[model samples]
Target: MSVNARRLAAATLATGVIAGLVGLACIHLLHWIQALAWDMHGGTLLEAASAVSPTRRILVLTLGGVIGALSWFLLFRRNKAITSVSAAVSGTPMPPLRATWHALTQVLIVGLGASVGREVAPREMAAAFSAAAADRLGLSAEDRRIIVACGAGAGLAAVYSIPLSGAVYTLEILLVSRSGRAVAPAFLTSGIAVLISTGFTRPAPFYTVPTLTPSLSLTVFGALVGPLLGAAGWAFKQAVARVGAARPRDWRLLLTLPAAFLVVGLIASRLPSVLGNGQASAQTQFDATWAAGAGLAFAALVLAAKTLTTFLTIRAGGWGGVLTPAVALGAGLGAVIGLPWAAAWPGSEVAAFAFIGAAAFLGASMNAPFTGLILVIEFTAQGPTILVPAVLAVGGATAATTWLTRHAR
Candidate 1:
C-alpha cells in the first residue's frame, strides 16, 4: 500500500476502535441510568416500564422530556450543528465536543424513558470523532467524509452487532457511494467495531422467533400484504418530516416538548408497550401467544400509539433513531393483519407475519430494502426459511414506497 493509503487505513482502524469503545460506553451508561431512574434491571425500556407504576411512568417520561429539551437548548441550539451522520459524511463539519454532548444527551433522554431509540448517540459521536481525527491528519475532504462514514457505520455495528448491515448502511445511506475505497474502509471499520463490542458484551440477537414454515402460500400472502406496510412506512417518514418542518424551532423546547411528552405519557399509561423504542412490544408480537381477537386489538392499539408517540418524540426534539420504532410498528401491524390469516390457515403463525412486517416496513421507510432484510435476519437469527417470504415482502414494499415517493413529488 502507498504511504497515504496506509495512513488512511490506520486512521480508519483507530476510528473503529474509538467508535466501538464509545458505543459500549453509551450502552452501559443507558443501562446504568435506567437502573437508577426506574429501579429496574437491565432489560429494555419496555420491560422497565412494566415494573413501574403508570403514574411513575408518566412522571419519568415528562421529566425526561423537560431534561431533554433543556439539554438541546443548552448544548445544541447555540452550535452551528451538523446533527446528522449523513451530513457529516457529506463534509459538514461538527465539533467533536459538541457532538459528544449531543450524544450524551440522547443517551440520557432514552434512559429517562423517552419514546425513542438510543442508536443515534453512538453514531453521531463516532462521526464527530472521525471527522476531527481526519482533520488533524490533514486528509482530503473526500477522505475525511469516507472516514466519518466508516466511523458512523462502526458505531452502528458495535451497538447492533450487525457488521454487514452497518457497512451497507454507510455505503447505501450515509456515503451514497459504491467506490472500492469507501467499501473497503467501511467493512473493515464495521468488522473491527463489532469485534471490540463483542469482547465487552455477549452476542445476543435482539429478537427470538419460533420455528416457522415458509410456504408458497405465505410468500404470496407476503407479497399481497407488503404494500400496505410500504405505504405505512412512507407515511411515517413523511409525517415525521412534515412535523419537523411545520414546527417552529423555538416552540420545540417550550411548547411542543412538554405537550408531546404528556401525550406519550397518557398513551403509556394504557399501553406500556408504546414506551421506549418498541423492542419489547415487537418481541411480544413475535411470541404469538395472544388469542386472535385480543392479539389484534392489542397490536392495533400499539401500532397506533407507537406511531403517534414516535412522531411526537421526534417532533418534540427528542434525539433518537426511528428504526426500532418502525420495526415495532411493523411487527404490531403484521400481527394484527395475521390474526385473520391464522384463523383461515390453521398452521400459519402470526409471528411470521410480524417478522415480514418488520422487514417490509423498515425497508420501505429507510428506502434501503436490503438493510431492512439483513437487520431482521440478524435480529431474529433466522435462516433461509424466512428469507424467501421476507424478500417478497421487502421487494413489494420497496416498489410501492418508491412509486409513492415519485408520485408524491
Candidate 2:
C-alpha cells in the first residue's frame, strides 16, 4: 500500500478506538449522574422521576440548570468557540480541550435530567479526538474529513450499539456520500466501535417491544401517515433551528437556563416521562396497550410535553441532539393518528403504528430516510416484515421534507 493509504487506514482504526473509549466514558458518566441525582439505580429514568416528589423534581432540575449554566459560562469565558462536527470535517480547527469539556458538559446536563438527547455528546467527543488524531497522523484533507465523520458515527454506534445505523448516519447524513471511499471507512469504524464498546454498554435492541405483526392496516397507515409526520417533522426542525440560533450566549444564560429548566421541572412534576431525552416516553409508547381513545390522549399529552421541553432546553443555552426527541414525537404522532385509524380499520396495534412513526418521523426530521429506518429496526431488534411499511413511509417522509426544504430555500 502507498504511504497515504496506510496513514488513512491507521487513522480510521484510531478513530474507531477513540470513539469506543469516548462512548464508554460518556455513557458511564451519564448513568452515574442520573443515579446520583434521581437515585435511579436500576429502573428507567421515568421510574426514578416518578418515584421522586414534585418538589424534589423541581429542585433537582433547577439545580442542574444552574450547574449547566455555570459550566458553560466558564467554558466559554475565554472566548474560544468550538466548531461542530460538520465544520471540523470541513477543515475547521477544533480545540481539543475545549471540545472535550464541551462534550462532557452536555453529557453531564443530560445525566442531571436535562430535557435533550445524549447522542450528541459522544459524537462531539469522537469528532474532536478524530480531528486531533488526523492532525497528528498527517492525513490528507479528504481523508481527514472521511475519518472524522466516520469517527462521529462510530461514537453514535458505540453508544447505541447500532453499527449499521452508525455507518448509514455517517455516509447518508454527515458526509452525504455514497462513494466507495466513504463507504468502507464508515462501516469499519462504526463496526469496530460497536464491538469494542458492547462489553461496557447496553446490549442491542436498546428499547424492547412485544411481538408486532404487519398487516394491511399497518401498510396503509404507514403510507398515509408519512406525509403528516413529514410536515410535522419539518416544522419541528425549523422551530428548533430558530430557537437554537437565538439561544442565550452571554450573561443572560444563567437566568434563562435555570428558568427554562424550572418550566421543564414544573411540567415534569405532572408528566415525569418528559424528563431526560424522550427514552422513557418512547419506551412507554412502545409498550402501550391502551385502546384507541386512551392511547390517543396519552400520546397527545406526552407529545406536547416532550416538544415544549425539548425546545425550551435548546432555547435556554443547552446543547444536545434532537434524535430521541424526534422519536418521542413520532411515536406520539403515530399513536395519536393511528388510534383513530385503528378504530376505523382494525388490524394493527397502536404500538405498531408508533414503531412505524418513529422511523418515518426520524427520517423526515433528519432528512435521512435510510438511517431513520435502520435505526428503528436496530433499536428494537425487530424483523424485516415491518420494513415494507417502514421503507414506504420513510421514502414518503423524506420526499416531503426534501421538497419543503428546497422550496423554502
Top TM-score: which candidate number? 2
RMSD of each: 1.9, 1.6
Candidate that would win on lDDT? 2
lDDT, model 2, position 341: 88
Clashing pairs in 1: none
- Report the C-alpha lDDT of model 2 over 1-409, residue by residue, as the tens digit: 9998899999989999999988888878988999999998986898899999999999899988998899888887768366888888888887778888888888888887888998988998899899899889999889999999998999999888889999999999889999998899999999889878886445747777777888999898878778878878888888888998888768888899999999999998998988998888788788775553466777788888898999989988998989988888888888888888888998877778888889889888888888888888888887386778777788788888988999999
| Model 1, residue 129: C-alpha shift (Å) | 0.4
Q: Residue 343 of model 1: what lDDT?
A: 71
| Number of clashing residue pairs, candidate 1 | 0
The Cα local distance difference test for each model comes to 0.81, 0.86
Clashes of 2: 0
